[model samples]
Target: MGPSRIIAVRHGESEANLAYRRAGERPLVYGRGDDEVTLTALGREQAAALGRLLAALPAGEEPEQVWCSPYRRALDTWEGARAAWGAGPLPLTVDDRLRDQEQGAFARLNPAAVRERFPGEPARREAEGAYAFRPPGGESLADVVVRLRAFVRHLERRADGRRVLIVAHDSVVLGLRHVIAGAPDAELAAVLEFAPVLNASVSVWRTGEGAFELVRFNDVGHLTS
Candidate 1:
């Protein structure tokens, strides 16, 4: 049996997110690696909001276990949420597999920079589509799916019948959707193009008769309310 419920949350907005937003067409370079980027002030507030929302859940629906990415932003977000929850500690594990999709040489480069740097990558990415396009030395969405599949199997083995919470990146959320729904490449690509996941958003899945069903996707009502 799998987990009775799975709640996945994307990390709060990070310095990188803000940098990219403000960079416009210029090449935005990070002084630190992606894993080291911390959340912005607003991101911390968003995380605290998530914590409060979780604390308000019915007793039966509360999370039993927590899995989080090891990245700094994710760790900080979890810390912020946990502090706001003010509840007894839940078992928390930092898993490298939950880390964001690796962008390789294209890590912080905008499309224009990527085009200027690699020259051929844009055309190649376009040709391969979102699912199959592996950045210079990075993993493709398909690669992310491979690792996430392993993680899901691990969850089934370790967290059966429990409520589990996962704090991870947008790519991990997307990968989980693909893995759980058994979605095709085209469908996943469509989602990538049309429905980008938001910072600190919550997605939920429930299991019944050994099948996982999506209850919500990219829900940020908690942040607004």
Candidate 2:
């Protein structure tokens, strides 16, 4: 049986975001790898806010199963959010499938810097088409969708109508959306262009009529405060 509900949340603002904002004129040197990036102070608050929001949900809607990315930022969010969720066993499990997409040469380069440092990448990415384009050693957007699809299948098998929550990265959010949207591989690349992933936002999906339907995308009402 499929999960009754699935909530995908992006990790809150991270140190990378802060550094980017601070690097006004300088070429923001690579600070840390994607997996190593940690959430900022406000990010911790955002995670706590999410926890309260979830706690306020109807009991049945409260997440009974939590799937989180193994990355530090995502894990930190879960650690903070789970506190407001409940007192007993958290039922939280980390899955590598939900981790951020691997980055090769693009590991920590700013977008603008990418063109200056890796001149061939842009043309090659454009030539191959965004969906199928893989960086020097990283996976493509389509690759992420494939792994997310596998995670969905795993969810179908394990969720069994339970309310489920997924805390992960921006790419994972888009990846999950691409998988659920059931778009053709050709269209997968445009998913990000059309659906912007929001940090600390919750995207809710429900499955009942033999397919998943997105009931809400990027809901961040809790962060208003």
The deviation in Å at residue 51 for candidate 1 is: 0.4
Q: What does candidate 1 score on TM?
A: 0.95
lDDT score for candidate 1 against the true structure: 0.89
Against the true structure, what is each candidate's TM-score?
0.95, 0.92
Model 2 TM-score relative to the real fold: 0.92
Relative to the unseen true structure, what is the Cα RMSD of model 1?
Answer: 1.5
Model 1, 142-220: lDDT tens digits are 8888899899999989998999999999999989888888777557675575258899999999986668888999999
Cα error, residue 76 of model 1, in Å, equals 0.7
**Residue pairs of candidate 1 with colliding backbone atoms:** none
Best candidate (score: lDDT): 1
Which digits, one per residue and each the tens of the lDDT, describe model 2 over residues 1-225?
Answer: 678899999998889878877776566666788888899999999999998898888867888889999889999998888886654666787999998877677878776677778888889888988768888899887888888999989988988888899999888998888888777776776776745677799999988578889998888888996
Lowest lDDT sum, 10 consecutive residues, model 1, at 186-195
Candidate 1 regions exceeding 4 Å error are: 184-190
lDDT values for all models: 0.89, 0.84
